[model samples]
Target: MKNVMISLAVMGAFGLSMPAMATGLVAIPAAGFTGTAYTLCNTTGNFGSSTPTQPTTGANNTCATFPANEATSPVSGYTLIASTNRNAVIGGITVGAVSDRVWRNTAQTSCIFGARFTASNIDWDTATTGTQYFEVNDIARGGFGSASVNAGYYIQATNASPVYRIGRTFTSVQHRAYKYDTAANKLLLGTNYLDLPTANSVNTALTGEVTGIGPTVVASTTSATQDAIVNSNWIDFTIDVAYVDDDGGSNIVSAMTYVEAACDSSAVSGWVKTGAIRLRQTGQENTTLQEISIDGYAPPGSTVP
Candidate 1:
């Protein structure tokens, strides 16, 4: 995935011409996706992070300018607000070419994030006793701790409790953004700007098999399927309120907390600027977690000296 990102960057650095790209729509899956008819536009291209300009739809959805590559990058009109890379061996799993990034649009109203785990041979077999978890966070400073509790907004998935969830930090609350409306059989959140029923399409671990959201896990390279190495390898996300019903309920139009903080007078915690990823590989100690940070860029709507 690093190679894919670098290649795209190189093409931009050169005078090479790329094809035209546009955004597409994404559906937020409700419990059984029973009565949820909401959808958000896919701001990033088909390559997700690699080609920011081309957001394709349906089959053969790669940007016309570049070949289909399972990588992530900021979409057109959006800036790379945060990015980080991880290359090492964790828990005997060779972690290579892994990147986590967050992108904010020009209006500062929305942000997109993506992570690619191109590392080979990451035996994520269901038969194993290991557990895997992934989460995207916006915090004041780099690294993870109590600060990430409700910095801005986040989406998390795992093989344990709170299987899948999303939240925003407008008020002081423990996991405020994640609330399951059992009676309605829908997900409730402080700021419903997060596209519900969100799924990690590129990564199998974050798919319905683990998070109970989005599409079924792609078939693994192995006959039995369930290998994260050969099947689910990358993940991407979008956080925006540009649609008709940003909150998924009330059908009332609204703005996202991150957008309000960056553009309006909305009061909340410190700016939801820093974006991070936390992962707990299967078989890792229950108390252990790995966090990656992308704190290099200044928050949108800020003055850079």
Candidate 2:
């Protein structure tokens, strides 16, 4: 009967562990998670006033986010491309801290600039509402038994819609250097690099800010359990993409966007259950997450300087 996000009081109640530090990394395979995974979200904009792309579940998962004006996005026109054709059976919940890649294309339409972005979800997927809800885990009161697989980081989306708000739960994430798929609409998630972009990681919100002292980690024993933390401070993760223009035409496009979130665990919109002591489905554990990193990007090349 508590907030699904695992309250700080609950953590304090469970903090009576064998040997652990207040701000140290949690052991891996903790919180019902055997490995690590990054949740991804896409938005449209520049650092100043960019907006997250509308989460339209089952509507051909969007890969790009174009800002409103040139001041908002680098894409000439405020156009976000949606690819058709069920290319390689995409869309599903992937688990663990696995290596993933991001690629985008115009789907053979031959657009001016092929652009798109993807990010790691904070706790669950709040892109859809009403039965289509997807979440990592929700802990019950008294540390009964709970199970969760949220990697503690999400590139959340923000808006008035219930879905967007729910998507920004727990921990937030930041991304960089979205690559271009070799195939027209194939959003690749692996190797094959060209020229990468420089990325910097700032703990604007990082995951611990809203969730726990560390990443989202939980362990439930007989009477005590370590789990997600709950705070209400607005969390922010930003990425600034820079493109230098050697051509006199001024084709340089460098901009960034910020994805803000909160440490709320209301469980209202749509929160699923992971691993917890409440359900008697979890056991003692620990997990340490790696820092987020930017993938890679290639700027448009020109002969003129």
Candidate 3:
């Protein structure tokens, strides 16, 4: 919703009032635990190597997803949407760097399969003192591959060794009960056990597991609703992401240009050639500058020429 408004505001500012036929815009809000640096489910913690050891900041050999309200511990009550695919394949969002395997918990005792996490009330993250960054953790896997007490996930100090035991505030965006019957980008993928934060910049490497994305935006029906001037010949598209804070941290972004496709100038190129036209009316073959009216599209201040 906020991203759309920003796009429209840019148009109006430049005298591009929402095209008359521009009925509505779609927005994809990222609602879930983006990532809060938590501790690895380590046993030896010597960057714990595994028969199933979660080294200092790593993941494990299991994956699971759920609907909201299924409890984990510390925090609960989240309806965040997420998804999971088999064998390192993610959906929707762009994929990045990949690794064969990093240190993780494979130990039987430490590898409790079904675990979950939720949000935290603590001020672990602050503009100043910058510290603590892990996305989500499977708390049940804390004491992985055989070792001592399960201590980690929630911590008390800046980068202080992770709180390795239970009965502490762990964090995440959603849990089992929040799962809706239908969703896409809302879902999360990957072992994501004991995730570590990359650099502060938006584009940087972070995790050691395979992650994929589902579709961020919902689908629309063909020839669906449009505004007063629907120019079907060309689809006007605007995409944006939140760059900085707005009314409690939002993703309001600006412009980017289009890239030519790989099929440019080829037979299957998106642009149609003159020979492709099939006019039923006589003398139309030689005529140009014809205005096409798209179904359900009504462009502003535009009359069929």
Candidate 4:
């Protein structure tokens, strides 16, 4: 009986489609449930090392108390307050309602300075039947998904343990933002976001058969950098693979197997590039060839700044 042989190869292709999702203007609260306000006074010494004293000696030094209703519920999304002076103003959310609790300096006027609210210490009442939602502002600071609701990006959180939701399906690239631990020091992406049900399924879908080789062969490349420009903080990756198979001998040999090239920014880490080319034997040493190239881009904002 003639030996029937099968050879399979798999490559990691970085290229994937990311369609723009609708986003909306909304306020997310800061990480800490509460915030404190401080007042700055004048000093006559060297401006660099000199410290300012409180406007008042001891008791009266503290400015007017912050408003009561000012401990804004998740309702008031983005609120702005005027400066009482270059210094004195409400210090906390206690005495009365103030428009904006957070303040910005004249230099930062063009910038929206708001708290990136997070529900760390506060217990998230997910069990409540009502609209169990929290609000945050200055979302551009730190948050997953886009600010626009229509943009399809939204914040999601999970406890330290796994929680299952039934009747929901997700694509391979969909992600959810969640707290990984009690400290809330870091935000994490769950593998569940990848939504891969079984490892074998991915293996089968990407596997290709080996066929032939070409006279022209090329080696892989590598690139690295520590400092990068803002919008340009992305790494492009490409990989090429070459292999051959022999049917009569029921054997296969890899001609070249390596990463083509990789680029990275100061943000994300542990990125690699890879590709594959397969050849199958038609007769003795004759073969058929198929080539596939894989590429991906890693942007800076994706990781810690």
Candidate 5:
């Protein structure tokens, strides 16, 4: 339940254009970055060229695109690997639409989980409200299957869930690890409750959570709250595979980087549109070019890389 601090570095960028052949959960390297910042992009398509395209500020670049309606497969570029039954009812609440995808660096060293969604209004849970099942959000290893829950580790926020009894508005983000049963097809109780910001940044109370720094940008000190996820917004969280493993979990890192995984935002109920769930390799933990740790586990003096 401690606050993790890391200096904010400029968001890195890539220049490679989307390729037609590159598709699915294939790992591709986002050019090795020299600065402490990790390379990032808003790619919705395939990867091409020797250097992966870097992201720039104010550019809502398109790596993948969907039509006016929900898309089973991306119109162009890579396809989503996860199943369709994404937003299952948890804690007696039904998450409207939670579409997800995964991307990785070719090195398969670092891993990131990103969930995108569109909503006109965002909801928040307060301590006074007791518990509202739909207020929480989640990032899990498997898609919310039709018949059963996926067997793996999942990170769920407390919101107002009785599990942690969290009541704060912004601080409601709980970083607890829960396991699912393959045999039973259900989610087990959570353990290892670590306090985490709803969004990973110097200040979780600002738009910086949604508006990321771009490749050319040198540095950033801006801040914003966990605002609404509208207009196909994407929020990414760095996954510490080793940290989870040390805490009695296994294969989570491998499943995320090499195998299959899914992340979704239940922050908004009755979501208008669902976006791609993506994963990207950030290299191993404690690296000079790693993204900010979502669980506040940044190495001493580590800034966003």
Candidate 6:
């Protein structure tokens, strides 16, 4: 199995309008891979934060919107393609939405996954007293061996209530990856982890593990402990899976994951990158992943082109 590494970060001052809505944008990386990749940002936290709110019978709980200009970059031998922007809604209300974008290195990519939400408005601190809180969800390739992965992150606010806060609060960075079996509709291997700030200059890490057979894997991991805030607020994460297929033998696994943190600033955080590489099977050569810098800022203007 071969191990490949990918590093990523977001920079610049992007403009964001108020009114409590969800929006998404896509971007293509410099490198390419064999499988397909999709990025989704949902009102739910599965991708990161909580979920959006929705009415039971029929009300406005969800909505959809579009992003401005899409960007693309080429790295290695792959072409990264991004999307303009998109919106996600729950029930009828618009929790928070995202831009639906994807990157494909080849046509042989197989996987149809994205992100979703449960509710639109809920409180995070108290849920009952504080403000409305939301939940996040993720969708991945259904089958194993030849499946693709898709995930997203988003935020939502309470409509009538004025407790919920919108826009970038504290910078929170997270990442996850999974292997699935499309045939039986099962998840083979997966990981869910989160990194957040603690105290003054410390950061904490939280993680969840998935285990079991085809399509019936069970998740049983504790929440991450509170750590110092390494980088205040904004951060980036990436996951890479590299493997080899024999004529009729077992599938070789080579996985590499990375995390990038930006420096603390009243305006934005500076970029800092870190990564880890490992092989699932033995007899394979070990690989080293490179670190990349990231810049964070707000986008200017209301129209995206």
Best by TM-score: 1
Clash totals for all models, in order? Answer: 14, 39, 58, 39, 36, 70
RMSD of each: 18.2, 23.3, 27.4, 29.1, 20.8, 20.7
The true-structure Cα RMSD of candidate 4 reads: 29.1
Stretch of 10 with least lDDT, candidate 2: 276-285
TM-score of each: 0.29, 0.19, 0.15, 0.15, 0.24, 0.24
Please report the TM-score between candidate 1 and the true structure: 0.29
Model 1, position 186: C-alpha lDDT score: 23
Candidate 4, residues 1-305: lDDT per residue as tens digits? 00100100010022221221111111111110011000111111111011112122232111111122323221122223221111101122111111112222233211121221122222123354432112110011111111111000111111100101000001011112122122221123222322112221221111111222221211111111111111111111111111111111111111011110111223222221121111111111112221112211112222311
Off by over 4 Å in 3: 1-45, 52-74, 84-305
TM-score of 5: 0.24
Question: Which regions of candidate 2 are displaced past 4 Å?
Answer: 6-33, 41-186, 192-240, 243-305
* Candidate 1 runs further than 4 Å off: 1-32, 35-74, 121-305
Candidate 4: stretches off by over 4 Å: 1-109, 116-189, 192-305
In order, the Cα lDDT scores of the candidates are 0.25, 0.20, 0.18, 0.16, 0.22, 0.20
lDDT of 1 by residue, 4-115 (tens): 3444355445634223122121211111122211112323321110112221244222211121221322234555555556453445544333344555556655444444
lDDT of 6 by residue, 128-230 (tens): 3433222221111111111111112221212211111111111122222132223221212234322221223223221122222222333222334222232
Best by lDDT: 1
At residue 79, give the lDDT of candidate 1. Answer: 58
Per-residue lDDT for 90-164 in model 5, tens only?
223332333343332233322223333211121112332432112112221211221110111121221110011
- TM-score, candidate 3, is 0.15
Q: How many clashes in candidate 3?
A: 58
In Å, residue 63's CA in model 2 sits off its true spot by 16
